[model samples]
Target: MKNDVKIRNEMLSWYDAHARVLPWRSKPSERPDPYYVWLSEVMLQQTTVQAVVPYFEKFISIWPTVHDLASATQDDVLREWAGLGYYSRARNLYKCAQAIVSEHDGIFPNSVKTLKSLSGIGDYTSAAIASIAFDIPSVVIDGNVERVISRLHRIDAPLPDSKTIIREYAQNLFIGDNTDRPSCFAQSLMDLGATICTPKSPKCEICPISKYCVAFEHCDAQVYPKKRKKSKIPEKYGVAYIYVHDGKVGIEKRPEKGMLAGMVGFPTSEWNEDSVDNIDDDMSAYKIRHVFTHFALTLYPQIINQKTYNMIEFKEVDKIGLPTLFKKVWNMIESDL
Candidate 1:
């Protein structure tokens, strides 16, 4: 066998024994469920596997199929997806499920073009669902795969710039096509990258493809996938109002567009750079600090005792969906009550 074939075989063999038993994955010989694959891939974007597992299980338990998910209200979907961050994914997920039912007759599209036409399915997600669920041979490159391929070939370029070459190298693994079960090979690379070829402190000694890895041969495998430094994120200050009346609390649904779209949260003044140190009130003691991908937020939580029309039972506020930012405010105050 050629070197690449040998490496592929080794990877498949390793995957057979050590594949991560995720709720969404199937054994090498079994066919994967497309709905599960699509849902899991969508949830996995900008989320860690460990963090996504429970959410995946919850979603599967609540909405077993695409049709069931499509039937759910957007508010219901966003409620379950509350703490998952990236509220946009939850919105798109609802839209995509409805599209799959309406546009494709509840069957996920097998081709990349058709899949990408859906709400949130893009290049990576489309390729992943196509290959893993439909057994269509395609290159599926994610962050983990990027790291593994960059190190294996010792690509000198930094991320984003190196992604093109990394994907090209990854495509080389699917050389033998369906006869080789390239779908399994795709997952094997994912398993290898996720478990063995990690970003930090890679376990080179136990890696199945170490022999073929250029960076490993040179003793600098961990440094193969280089990255540019990120600029410091800016800071924003805001104040959230926790209005209380007889036995209820005030709540608001954010605008359909902006930072935390469609998610439930306390009403708040617009975020700015000013500090809340001057605005002294008893409820200001519960300060909330949250960090998003673009900026950090410091929220001064003010609990005002006033009757408001849009109110829910204060005791039942925990049942509704609130983003992590507002959840922090609830956590601090809930402890007192």
Candidate 2:
């Protein structure tokens, strides 16, 4: 326990000196804003810092406050979030903002419990907002935190299952009694894990808390935070109808409750588990490919007759909103048309 305190102090001091000057970092005289913290957290999920920086800046520039976000149209919100992927995050972000507007009068909640009640906020996100935005002494355990804790204690259990144990360990090391800087502390741990104590080839020589890191001492820091094996993503095949009539293109809204829900895409059928032999008869044009972290989707781009429409909407493809995945499909059609 004493060692933990020592390590925490060392990490905090190092963080004070070396923390990255990110847009979200609060100035000495400025208080952390829950809205910015929440936005950054949601954008950073399963995304890299470099990839999220521009999007974060753009969002802040456009909305500027929770009330602004709440007032923005859903289409505008989704359009801004288009390239960010994870359409669900964008949808949930709008939902959360609306909830704040309706229930909390556009003010972010201060406690983890209340924050969790908002759409898309889970345990990690709630803790992050509570600690960073409100300085509430809550433990914010992200993937970086998990890595740092697992290495410090030389924990070898597979992650997700080991997350709770690691969170408890971090909770024990909290310096709430000495400082009202939980935000900096949490950010410091994240920076340390990301920059120095990385998952692969950790730079222990430059690490401030390496003296107390159990995994470092044991020469196994690289492998301490073990993870479960990833399951193979099954390949899938589908047909997309890129029907163009006059100067407009046909597009459809995905079902409201599945993958890529509520996003605009070319009309497509349910993906088949097996590779399709041919879609030439049913499609005017077709293409095949795979997406990262998802199954392979073959798009059978078909130019349908104008008389076949019943529920589909037609618009100038460039004028309508489209998710990145479908945007790629549109590009393919543009090359051919």
Candidate 3:
């Protein structure tokens, strides 16, 4: 057997004995449920596993199946998915559930090509769902897998640019394993990168496949997945106008396009790169800052003795689907009330 085959076998064997027991993952003896797989994969995008656990449990508990989720209102879904940033995923999750129920008769498509056609199921997500849930042969490469591949081959190219090379390298691992469990093989790579071959200070000593890792041999595993220098993130300024009446706060749905699109938030001024911060001494309650993927936002909360027709009870704020940025602003202003 080739070195790649040896590495693959060792990785899967390590995974079988030490796989992280996540709620959505099926036991080794059982096949995974496609709905749970798709839902967990969607929730895990750009979000940490710790943050996604409660949200995943809540969503699965409330909407047990695709059909149940399809019947749920978009507002309810968003509410349940609050705090797990990337609100568009919640929107797409609803649409995908509906599509699965109506288009595919409530059954998740087992093929990568078919899964890709679903809303929000991109190339990576589709591969993940096809391989993990259905036991199909598919190349699943996320950030973790990319790091592992880059280190294993000592690929020096910077990320985003090196992604194609890393993916091709990862693809070879799952190519001829007809008898092996492809799902375990794919997930093991992910888990290995997550736990052992981490981006920073990787626990190389305990890494199962460290013998085959080119970067590890050279003592440069941390530097394998080189990344381009990020451009300075621009800062945007805005004011969140908090209105309270009868113990309810004013919240409105943002426009269905642009930042925080279609999510619930307090009324605010435009978040512009050059926007001036017009904070009055009496009106300004607090200033809060949040960093997004592309930009940093500074929001000045101005409390008013006025009320808008749109009001949600302050005690019920947890039930409303407020994005992380808005939630931070709310926490700052809520203390004043």
Candidate 4:
């Protein structure tokens, strides 16, 4: 841990040469727009970088600035944010935009406390925005940072319990003056953990700071940040009524609360583990399995003859944006055609 100088220098030098060319990223020494940084950070939460790029670009093109986003309607924002999952992020995102415009005069707050005061901006996000966008030296701890710190020190404690200690280590590792380097250093850990120090089969030979990694010296880096056995993920069941007439399919807006709230999805029965028995299996019924963070969902999508339904053309369905769960329903219906 005395090698902070070595670790920070090597990591930043590598970052300058090999930072990912993301749509929202500025160069290692350069600062990105705060709006862009905030939006990208929120979208990147619980979603992969690969999945967020197009949506990021689309949002940028559509709403260009905080004021523009603030003026946009909630439905429009949620529509654009569909398939990105975490519909609540989209809702809170809209609220955050309005808050920034109304309260902060369309400017992002500079401090962690002020940023967290906005909708959907939590501890990790506030720190990320402060360091990366505003060039404030805030400790940014994410899953990737957790992995790198856990491996760098070879901490054997499992996650959640180990989070505080890992964060303390991260705080020390990133210690320095409040400069542009903090931004670059914050992103560098993300880049390092993502590309080189991956979860499985990390590329230690190419790692810049492998010389300083205790786990690498012991030849068992992956075993650090030890994890406990994950409990069994319970399964939930429901039926999706894919009511089709003409060349279009039926879709409905979910109620304003619970899962997939305020998003467009196929009409269905109540989701319950016990409801699995009530769905009679017929030739037209196709079972689709979709996994969420907390539980796995098995949806019995059936072609039901129903009168109350909103129709959208098959070609225009993706344009309207369905959640990945309902997109699976569409895909199933298409394949059977």
Candidate 5:
């Protein structure tokens, strides 16, 4: 335990001197805003810091406050979140904002238990907000933290499922006093994992905790956080009906639930292994393939000549906001024309 204390103190000191200048970090004499912390955490889920930076900036500029976000229209929110992918996160973000307004009087809840009760606020998010916003003593175990902990202790359990044990270890190591600087500690661990103790080719030479990290001492950091073998994603086929009329394209809003929910996309149907039947109208077939995080999709772009379909709306293609997957479909249609 003495060694653990030494490790923690050394890591914190390194962090104080080396922490990156992120937008959410508070200035001296300024208390961290729960709203900003919550918003950033939600946007950062499954997204890279580089990718999320612009989105976070845009969101803060547009909404500015929890009340502003809660009162904004769903369409406006979805449109702002258009290219971010993971539409569910956007939807739940709105829901969470409204929840805070209605239940917590537009103020972000300070306690982990209360924050978790908000929509889309999971354990990780709650801990992040509690520590960063209210300066509460809470352990934040994000993916970066998990990797750092797993390597530091040389735990070999596969990722995701191994998260619980990793969290337990982190909780044990936490030095949470009443006035503990949980925010700095949490972000420091994350920064260490992200920059130094990375998943591949860790930079242990400059790591402050290298002396105590078991994986570094053993030179097996890459092998500490074992990952389960990923199963091959089955190929699924779908048809995107591209109806062009008067130099405009026809798009439909996806259902309010499920994949790509509430986003404007090309008209499509359930995917199957076999080709679509009953070819209607004079349309040329183009093929495009795309890969989601979990599935592979093969889209058969059937271009229906504008003469046959009267139920179409046309606007300059460049003016439309389409999902990335559907953007590929549009590019295929334009290139083939």
Candidate 6:
């Protein structure tokens, strides 16, 4: 196996000049805060960096430290994390914060193994927190790094299956020197993959590591880190009952398990594979479609002007922290009222 010394040096040099200035990231001259790094990493799971910025800022402003977060109620955290999808992360984040405060004296463990023991933290997140926050030389391979490495070696194996090979190569790449900033080295690969070796229409002409890329030699840089075709997503359907009276709307808490658990939403019919029947014309105000990871949903929202049920004032709907699916339904029907 060839040494990654030259590749590492070139990539790190490019990163120093062009690395993204993100809210959670620290400049090379500064030390990263573990709290910021951990919070950002959790929010970033199955989410884009662009979407995570405002949420991270808002979270830090509200709960500046792990202790503050641990002291917060899970419902408040869920509310703050509203619109950011992947609700489970918020729950796990709350659990992990509590664990850190109660068990570890509010200090985030620097080692990957100990970090993994926290709620919601897995291999990749632990590696990221260890390397970026603590400057530990742990192997960190996110989607971007996988793409870059797959292209560099021109590996044709599809992702998931190719994950082991990709990780092996990434570990090898980071093995050469301890003196080099491990944090910078790991983030450089991530930056390269995100900005230059993008999934579609990679900007190979200006890529700093293009000289070392085997995929570039064959003129197929975009083709590395192959993924299998996605299976068909089944459609699920439901009807939302929106009851409003005296400037208030009725909302209910979802069960503490399954989709949108413990989040506030307007009362709704059961979501099922089959469609509902005998829907009245006046009740059906609007129809909205939302997509989840495993399925798509078509929700029929019905408006009922009634004061029988307990309600939240319309002006305070923001406090409910409804998930994106319910938020979309609200947006669609809120205008008519």
> Which ranges in model 2 have alpha carbons more than 4 Å from their true place?
175-180, 280-286, 292-294, 304-319
**In what order do the candidates fall by lDDT, top score first?**
6, 4, 3, 1, 2, 5
- By TM-score, the candidates rank as 6, 3, 1, 4, 5, 2
Each prediction's number of clashing residue pairs: 0, 2, 0, 0, 0, 0
Candidate 2 lDDT score at position 251: 67
In angstroms, how far off is 56's CA in candidate 6? 0.6
Candidate 1 lDDT at 67 equals: 98
Instruction: Please report, in order, the local distance difference test score of every candidate based on alpha carbons.
Output: 0.86, 0.81, 0.86, 0.87, 0.80, 0.88
Model 4: weakest 10-residue lDDT segment is: 171-180
Measured on C-alpha atoms, candidate 2 has an lDDT of 0.81
lDDT of 6 by residue, 187-271 (tens): 8877877778899999999998888889999999887778998999999888899998888899998898999888889889988
Model 6 accuracy (lDDT, Cα): 0.88
Q: What tens-digit string does per-residue lDDT give for candidate 5 at 1-337?
A: 5565777778779988998878877874688777888888998998788888898898889989999999998888888888788998888999999988998888777889988887788988899888778877787888888888899889877887798888777776664322246777778887898788888888989999899889888988888688898998877778888886666667778899877899888888787756556642245366678888777787878777664333344444544567788878877678555
1-337 per-residue lDDT for model 4 (tens digits): 5677779889999998998988898764566899999999999997689999999999999999989999999989989998898999999999999999999988789999999888999989999999889878888988889889888999988987899898788777766422347888899999998899988888999999999999999999977668888998888988888777777778888898999899888898888777566566554368899998888998998785544557877788887768899988888887553
**What TM-score would candidate 3 get against the native?**
0.95
Q: Give the candidate number with the greatest lDDT.
A: 6
| Shift of residue 210 alpha carbon in model 1, Å | 0.4
Task: List per-candidate RMSD values in Å.
Answer: 2.0, 2.9, 1.8, 2.1, 3.0, 1.7
Cα lDDT of model 1 by residue, 242-323, tens digit: 8887888899999999999998899999887666656754545777789989889888888888977689987788889888
Range of the 10 consecutive residues with the lowest summed lDDT in candidate 3: 275-284
Error of 6 at 92 (Å): 0.7
Error of 2 at 120 (Å): 1.3
Higher-lDDT candidate among 3 and 5?
A: 3
Which residue ranges in model 1 land beyond 4 Å of their true spot?
175-179, 280-283
C-alpha lDDT (0 to 100) for residue 37 of candidate 6: 95
Error of 1 at 320 (Å): 0.7
